[model samples]
Target: MPKGKKKTESRGAGLEEYLEGTVFLDLWRDKMFLGQEFLTWLYLTSEKNNHFFELPGGDGVEAFFENRLTLSHGRGNNRRSVAITTTEEPRDPDWDEAYTAIGNNKRVIKGTLRVKAENREWRLTLPHDTLSPQGVKLSAVKDPAETDDLGKAGKFLDKIALTAELVSIVDELFSLFLSRRLSETWLTEDVPRLKEYLSSRT
Candidate 1:
């Protein structure tokens, strides 16, 4: 027998046994909770800290929940979901409906966000499960069609740079969240304060 085939068989020997339980389902559910916890923390920090953040690299950013926010709880057939939306130019941070849902133990799972760095801004919807930006809108770039053929390349590069910058900002923020979330201070200090903040709102 080929060496690779032998190794594959060795690795697969106990696969059937390991696949025969609820372990994988439990692990997946745990991961989903991490996403919910991260978004919940992000919302709490955004409100308490006035939507201002200092990145690990010393740059400042302002990110706020805007227009739409979705929160969810439970799993399978027991799952509950809520969406909060507004037409106000600057959404009221003290929106009662959002606070009521949070007070009821819902966690933010999807949200529309506005993030600003320097003078540039990005608007996007972020889903907790994938943590991927959706419907992204970046600061206006020069219209490629209006530019000379030579300048069109430059405009294209400009768009790419803006996209990259947005990704970098979001990645940094998520990294910051994970680091804090995994720390003991999260349960001891952060969560207690988070509860207090939520209570005051609702």
Candidate 2:
């Protein structure tokens, strides 16, 4: 058999076993579950979140909401607080493959977010006499304007979509690597060719 055909057959068998109940299959499943759990945890932990826009020239703009929740009785009350921040980054030369070292020279809109929740106590008890119920609050901390020409752009980045795109990219890159299509100059040469092939499918 030809060497390439043998290698292909070997890889096919490995992949088949990976899709079966093999140890490698379990490892892959576990990793995927871990990643899903992490993302879900992040969403649940944050009380409030914001999205910002990145301008072309220098700075950016953002808009966010502050949430404050209060639990009150006749005389006693409790307060809880949280915050969310959203920001955008324009597609620029700086964020290209040469700088970010991710993959292609695609411009990414990045969002920076933070959330905090605290419980506050009341002095006197009112009609209801139960253990202190927590109050939830959320706020947006930073909103900086730009000195450059580019104004703020409003575009939401869905985490699920981004994750899917990432997975696709990884799958493609791995297939290329396994096929020995990637070399030291792969980034400079083969990457574009692979992209063209991918584009043709669309």
Candidate 3:
């Protein structure tokens, strides 16, 4: 093989093993709800020279949920949106150095990974966010008015339901990311496991 091809194959093999290991699967199993949590970890480590929660303030996880009834009645956007932000403070100065080097070089990274739900189907999303010098923001956008509600009460109830779901998913995903075991192959293998875990709780 050519030198470049040989290097590529070697790295690919190592990543493959990394994916199959228990460490990866366990992490996937934990953060099954917040879909992009694992990607956040990988991005920070590789590009930012940081560990999960490595920033001075550590990681911050936030979820936002809106309900239509509250908005329609209260006079506002009448739409619901959920957003989560996770921030990591670097404990080691070395991490800061690495991040500075990568950012200055402006490297582009691309890959695919799968996240499995409790229903035996994998949920896949483009696991990327626009990176700013400050931190990362994860957002889910959906129109709240699209929900079928007969009246104000119904709309209120719907909002509550949506918020509850968002909270639950955020909690699970945040916990998983903090544990630091998420890897590409493990997420692919644990779709069914995650589904089972979520189903049991619900």
Instruction: List per-prediction Cα lDDT, in the order shown.
Output: 0.81, 0.27, 0.33
lDDT of 1 at 56: 73
Can you write out model 3's per-residue Cα lDDT over 4-123, one digit (the tens) per residue? Answer: 112355445677667674686667546443333344344343223222222112332221111100100111264232232223332232333323322333221212222222221121
Residue 30 of model 3: what lDDT?
Answer: 64
Off by over 4 Å in 1: 1-29, 140-152
Ranking by TM-score: 1, 3, 2
Give the TM-scores of the predictions, in the order they appear. Answer: 0.79, 0.18, 0.24
lDDT of 1 at 140: 52
Model 2's alpha-carbon lDDT is: 0.27
Q: Model 1: per-residue lDDT, tens digit, 1-202?
A: 0011123566568877887875877766678877777777888888889999877777789988898999998887998999999999887878788888988889999999898887678899989887878888987544566555647778778677777788778877887898888888988987799889989888
Model 3 misplacement above 4 A: 1-39, 42-149, 181-202
User: Per-prediction RMSD in angstroms?
Assistant: 9.1, 22.6, 21.4
lDDT per residue as tens, model 2, 85-163: 2233332212122112112222111112222212211111111111111131222222434223324443123223333
Ranking by lDDT: 1, 3, 2
RMSD of 2: 22.6
**What is candidate 3's local distance difference test score?**
0.33
